[model samples]
Target: MHEFQLPDMTCGHCAGVVGQTLHLADPACKFQVDLPARKVTVQSDEDRAVLAEALADAGYPPA
Candidate 1:
């Protein structure tokens, strides 16, 4: 599992976009987003750097 702190994620819409972006990157991955906490926990076989890059490319770079 990979945990990321996304300081820019301020609302449900942000979370939804992040979720959709990650899902598109790796459909089999599982993840949970905590909007209030500005955190995201992802479970996937993909490399951490790759996942992080994907999120960054989608405009939700981790803090």
Candidate 2:
């Protein structure tokens, strides 16, 4: 799994946006958003950098 640490992702809305962004990038991806931990764990065939870039372009750059 690819884990992203989103420092500003702190709410359900952020999680939803993250989900949408990831789904747009990789429809087959499976993920979980942990708000308290500010983390997003993704299982995808896409490269980690691709996923990270997608998230970054969506304004949630991973740490």
Count of clashing residue pairs in every prediction: 0, 0
Please write out the lDDT profile of model 2 over residues 9-43, one tens digit for every residue.
98899999999999999999999999999999999
Off by over 4 Å in 2: none
Worst 10 residues of 2 by lDDT: 7-16
lDDT (CA) for every model shown?
Answer: 0.93, 0.95
Q: How accurate locally is residue 44 in candidate 2, as Cα lDDT from 0 to 100?
A: 97
**Candidate 1 Cα misplacement greater than 4 A, ranges:** none
lDDT of 2 at 2: 96
Model 1 clashing residue pairs (backbone): none
Residue 31's C-alpha lDDT in candidate 2?
A: 99
Task: Write out the backbone clash pairs for model 2.
Answer: none
